[model samples]
Target: MDPGCHKLYHVHGFDSRQFLEHYLSDKADMVFGEESLKFPIENLTKVFTEGHIKGDVLIDLSLSSMVHHLYSACEFFNHIIVLKAQDRCILELKRWLNTRTGAFDWGHATKLHADIEGKCDQLQDKEEKVRSAVQHVMRCNLEQENMTDPIVLPPADCIISTWILGAISKDQDEYIRYLRKFSGLLKPGGHLIIIEDLDGTYYTVGNERHHYLTCDEDFLRKALVGEGFVINYCKVQKRTNMSDLVDYSSSIFIAAHREKSV
Candidate 1:
């Protein structure tokens, strides 16, 4: 969902159900396998129940809308892991979370070390440069397979990747590979929530044509189940403007516990 809808649905005094219904009706093309009208009710209900924020640690992959939702609804967690392809998103989240008034100080210490590596030419010291080069090479090699460089992190209780897997890769195999990588990040019995673009969206954003890997609820459910995750809850809805100038429809995924664990 877009930031506007996040504020609309989650903020005080707005009739969430009414807004969702109107939003869904306006973007019928994106609703998966059902009428747009029913989708709002179904999605809202699941968001209330399954998306209920409860966990010591939370990981948000997209680092935008999902992070906004998680932060707005819940305030406390032992640790929160946010994964993003772009450094700007990560930095923005860190800044936003820190400004919140409470014991929850989203400070730099709260940010777990990232998986990114720097280039050899960027480092002045020879020894440091060599190490950086090696790490950079290793990360590049992993990226080819849609895998993330492994990093030691605090134990997490919840994992959220919203509009990330689909938004990052257009290749189906690559998309699935990234999904598997995300699943591997979670501990046994940890919750995994994902929101993605359902329709094959090809929209323009700042002179770039952003493409999405078209996927349905069944495809995602099957993939997650095959990867040892049990479908606690799932929904495919037409979300409000996922982009700024590019108003395209999208879908959401909310799953939990990799079977027999949680």
Candidate 2:
């Protein structure tokens, strides 16, 4: 692993397909299957079902081409906008949305969502829902003050970010700074749902190691509060499986509402 590759979010270096295969494949273990996939899917389903996180526009800032996190969200938010820092990721997502050949299959994830939602027979329907709801897949630059510059986005009713922050931020302060940028995208009192790898320093993709921030519950709570978010629900699951591909102790899911600007 090159020391320089572990410093910042290198847009072109990530292998989206390999990432899916290693961490979210059909044979994924407890860490990726349960912590990464099931935790967010189940919690987001519950939050949306509770009728409090109402939203029309939702922006997703997940890493790579992963769409498993959006299965439940598509049911709640009418329009979904996926923002990615890498063009490769955007292209990958577009391939799936356009039903192009060589696109990654999300059937397993869709089935999981159907099973959790108690509508097991609607597996194909759930997949279609996600495809239909996603209106745009735009490239983003997290280094820029306005990540989606030159194409200003409407204030989103909700923002769901997963794993991107940890990969983008090199330190805790940088994490809080990037998080503030996330807060700026939400409407006042709008919801912000974040799912992150907790206390992780690095994860590998096709032999390339990527940086991950090592943040704990206290730092995360303080960071959210400092950014004017009132956390409504938070859950953390300890890593149940060990792997050299990734080094993370736990995963965290937090549902918060941005404070109304006074």
Among all windows of 10 consecutive residues in model 1, the one with the lowest summed lDDT is 107-116
Model 1 TM-score on a 0 to 1 scale: 0.57
Every model's TM-score: 0.57, 0.94
After superposition, the stretches of candidate 1 with alpha carbons farther than 4 Å from their true spots are: 1-53, 63-66, 72-76, 98-151, 239-250, 260-262
* Tens digit of per-residue lDDT, candidate 2, span 164-234: 88888877888888898988888889999888888788888887788888889889999998888899999
Q: Report, for every candidate in turn, its global Cα lDDT versus the true structure.
A: 0.45, 0.84
Q: Quick one: RMSD of model 1?
A: 15.4
Which numbered prediction scores highest in TM-score against the true structure? 2
TM-score of 2: 0.94
